[model samples]
Target: MWATGLGSGVRALTTTRFGGHSRPPFDSLNLGIHVGDDPAAVQSNRLSLAGVLPANPVWLNQVHGVDVLQADRVQSDQEPVTADAAVTTRTRQVLAILTADCMPVVLADTRNRILGVAHAGWRGLARGVLAHTVQEMAMRTDGQSRIHAWIGPGIGPDAFQIGPEVRETFLEIDGRLEKFFRRDSSQQGKWLADLPGIARWQLLQLGACDVQWCGLCTMGDPDNRFFSYRRDGQTGRIATLAWIET
Candidate 1:
């Protein structure tokens, strides 16, 4: 577990690919039920995770889109919501985002007791998922909250290779994003994109006063500490969770 340094009133952390019941490719701690892991094993893993959380996390059916859900409105019996991000001001209402190479971002406004988490793949980032999440949190706080953000593990720059079209897509969003990509010498016409850096830039642009990153890379994990879809075609998902503590 990697905890965020977001001060008091909030609890946030990203889990590693350890400490659970799944086997082989999904490994011992696979948290995703939709990833072809055994349902019983996934349930056991979730129960284990829930032991440490304030409440059972509200999972999202992340589609790499920009939709954000209000986790406070979610009920325990409700099915998983179909959104990439979730926000809440309610204490102990856990918000979770699962990832395998894609970034998981947690945001907090400790003063106003707002919390948010987003599943940000390149597609979601290009589509403004972080922007939408920040906007939602701000809206709930009447646009006066001083938000802080913590970006969890994902593929790092040196390990994330992208094509010209992918680079063009980011450039189309913001010409300044060009700095986040550089030519991949080993792979002709391919670029090494800085996934976390782009997310940091986006958060700063949204007026987040403080931004931090776990600085771990799933794709570069030789120790198998994290799950990486780009590193392994079929793999388990690690989770990033956040909640306001009572």
Candidate 2:
């Protein structure tokens, strides 16, 4: 399910499970450092990835909240920060996020002036991670710059069931969020959530020119590509990366 494209000076790739050396639960190609995979193994896997890509990816301690990071300066954490996004203007410095079910979004301007990536789960989406990322990108671009966003493979709407708390979040943001919810078949209080729709809505709100989505359902498809947390409890992570290669 990994894909790549080149436009202006930007080059990007979203990695699937075809490439690493992690074990069964972690599988092969596990890029997450926080997962139970051995530190040495994780390091080796990442180093292996570096050989194919342009630069070292900027890994984040994603906490499903609204904080966003700048890739030029990243730190080792005593505790994971409450951030779900990262942006950068530097060339060959990759900004990446690890995700299982959560949406991993990559954005780049046509001028290659800036690039950003975000891990937007329900919590971070409700809190405005996309909006914040666009704002951060704006600081580097002129007012005329427009963001081109691509929505990578994620848990599709049919598989993402949520409770009333999610409904409450949409209501809190705007009463119109109810339109995205529909009753789940197996559960009474739970409704199938539309994560991709919500993410597209957020990106539109941010004035992105082109929004591309893979439309691949990670949860529904268990082939050799993605890692779905909701489907596989003790699972590995896949990465979506963005950077300016020019």
Candidate 3:
């Protein structure tokens, strides 16, 4: 459990690939059920994770899109809600987003009564997932003075290479986005994109100036402790979750 010390009343964590019943490839602590990992292993891992939390995590059937939902609106835990993000002002509602190489962004107002978590893949980011999540949080937080965001691990800029179309998507959002992508000299027609840099730029535009990053890269480490879909084609996912304390 990697904690994000956002402040007094909020708790956030990004799980590691170690500590569960899964086998190689999806080896131990694999929390994603949609991936090829065994359902039993995934459930067992979730159950183990539950023992440490105030309540069961409100998981989403993330579609790599920008849809954001309120945790209180989730009708059933058994139903997989097809949204990429979840936010709540209610305490103890463990809002979670699963990620392997994609970024897991967690947000909380300075008051710590409202919290949000988002799964931001390149598609989601290009489509404004972070911006949408920040808007929802600000709506709930109305007059709050600050919105703090913690950006969890993902494939770093040095490891993420993309084609022209991907760069165009971001440029469509903002022409200045070109600064976040650098030409990969070795790979023609490819550029190394900065997922975290793009996220920080979006958050800052939305007035979330206190953005914090857990500098560890999922694909950079050779230990395989942090799950990386780009590194291992068929791999497990780590959950980066946030909940307000009662």
Candidate 4:
């Protein structure tokens, strides 16, 4: 969500489709290589992002699962590890997760020495990606330090209508999760689930208090300021990244 309140030595940002060289569908700043976009154009866009980062981003081949990894353990940039989230205590090790309609959640410890970024869609949320990430990051710090998390833009609750099974997936975890969903009158047997709300609950349960969200809905913006894979079937992905500055 590009929050600065996490304090010094912490750097975080989420990209939109405003600048770069890819053509329509992936138009201009498409940083994801798995989206069928031209490889060179994606590389060019990655370079553009690199200019602002302390080091090259350790991008993930996000699979809507709960797998979380240490950023330094990732062996290659050419072959991104298949994980939905990444965490690191090392400086300049930028942790990145790409998304269009899925939520990107970033976390910072009180000291700003540890950072984590996660990709959470309905599947990942139901599978506990947010919980897994917080557990990984919190384990690195002592009991007294608080964890802060920010929810980056994705398809907001107003636009994220889902089927009954999707709702069931979460309710199965905790009946209290029912508060994050509402019946979708527009679509029979469907509900608009709050992706950010689910993540917020997960974060708070893990003792993260300073949780903030950008409140931007990729599908709701008519101007196409951000990419929306749900609004446009074939589309580029925007990136949300986090890191500790040297």
Candidate 5:
């Protein structure tokens, strides 16, 4: 798989199971630690993916919140970043996020001088992870850089139905976001969520000039290319990583 940059200098990619040493359930390239996949297998899977990554990836603990961390300071085997987002400026310092059903929103600036990655689940997205990531990236640069974002694969709309409380969260953040949800006629106080579009809008409002999406649904496509938590609760996770090549 080739890494697609937004015509920027950043080297970025989303991994497929074709690589790594993980086995069934995780199958071959699972990169998550808290998912109950064998630790040794997860380690081997990570090592197998390392050669392709620009540097060791900064893996996050991912509690589905809006916290953003700097990748270089992240220690290995420690409590994962806990933050849903991470930003990096130095070359060879990789930024990554693991997800099975949530959108992994990867970003790079126009000049490719900095990169940021965020995990946006329904809760995290509503909690402002995408906007927080853009804010963090701005803090690292001139505080006025125009960024670009590419939202990676995740569970899609028809598959992600949520209750009114979830809708209220985004509505509170930006009432315009309500346009992303369609009321579920059968389920009282429930709506079908448009996760990718919500993420794109969040970034745009934060300062990004361009936003693109892969538009693939992890739950809908099970061709061994993706792992889906919504479809398989015990399944593995995929990594979306980026770094500046020195």
Candidate 6:
């Protein structure tokens, strides 16, 4: 587990691909049920994870859109909500975002006890998922609280190669975003995109004053600690979860 150190009363962490009952490719500790891992193994893994949490996390369908759900309002028996982000002001309500290579972002206003988690891929970033999550948290605090964000493990700038259209999507949003992309020296007409850098920029722009990154790369995994979709297309997903410690 990688802790975010969000502060005294906040519990935020991202799970690595270790310590569970999955087989090869999915390996062990695969929390995502949709990734072709054995349902029994995935359930056992989730149960093991719940043993360390204050409550079972509220999972999302994560459509790579800007929709943010209220965790406190969700029913535990209901199916996973179709949203890329979730937020809560209620204590012990854990919000979870699953990802392989996509960035897992956790936000907290320790002052107001507001927590949020987002799954931001290139598409979600361009669609303003981080901004939407920040806005939702702000609404709960009446915009008086200062939000801090932690960007968990993801595909780093050097390992994430993209085409011209992906670069153009961000640039079209803000021409200044060109700084987050650079020509891939090895591949002609390809660009190395900075997923974490862009997320940090967006968080700062959204008034999240303290932005931290795990600085771990999913695709560049030398130890096989993380599950990377780009690195291993058939791999499982690791989860990033956050909640208020009641």
Model 2 clash tally, residue pairs: 2
* Alpha carbon deviation, residue 45, candidate 4 (Å): 0.8
Q: Please list the Cα RMSD from the true structure of every candidate, rounded to 1 decimal place.
A: 1.0, 2.5, 1.5, 1.6, 2.1, 1.1
Runs with alpha carbons beyond 4 Å of true place in candidate 4: 75-78
TM-scores of the models, in the order given? 0.97, 0.91, 0.95, 0.95, 0.91, 0.97
- 44-152: candidate 3 lDDT, tens digit per residue: 9999987678888988999999889878876436677889998898778888889999999988886647788899989999888988888788777546647788999
Point out where model 2 deviates above 4 Å: 1-6, 74-82, 222-224
Whole-model Cα lDDT of every candidate shown, in order: 0.89, 0.80, 0.86, 0.86, 0.81, 0.90
Off by over 4 Å in 5: 1-5, 75-79, 185-189, 222-224
lDDT measured at residue 202 in model 6 versus the true structure, 0 to 100 = 90
Q: Arrange candidates by lDDT, highest first: which order?
A: 6, 1, 3, 4, 5, 2
* Residue 181 displacement in candidate 2 (angstroms): 1.5
Write down the worst ten-residue block by lDDT for model 6. Answer: 1-10
lDDT of 1 by residue, 93-199 (tens): 88899999999999988767788899998999999999999888988776577888999999999899999999999998999999999999997889999999999
Name the better of 3 and 5 by TM-score: 3
The residue pairs found clashing in candidate 4 are none
What TM-score does structure 2 among the candidates reach?
0.91
Q: How far does residue 230 in candidate 2 sit from its true spot (Å)? A: 1.0
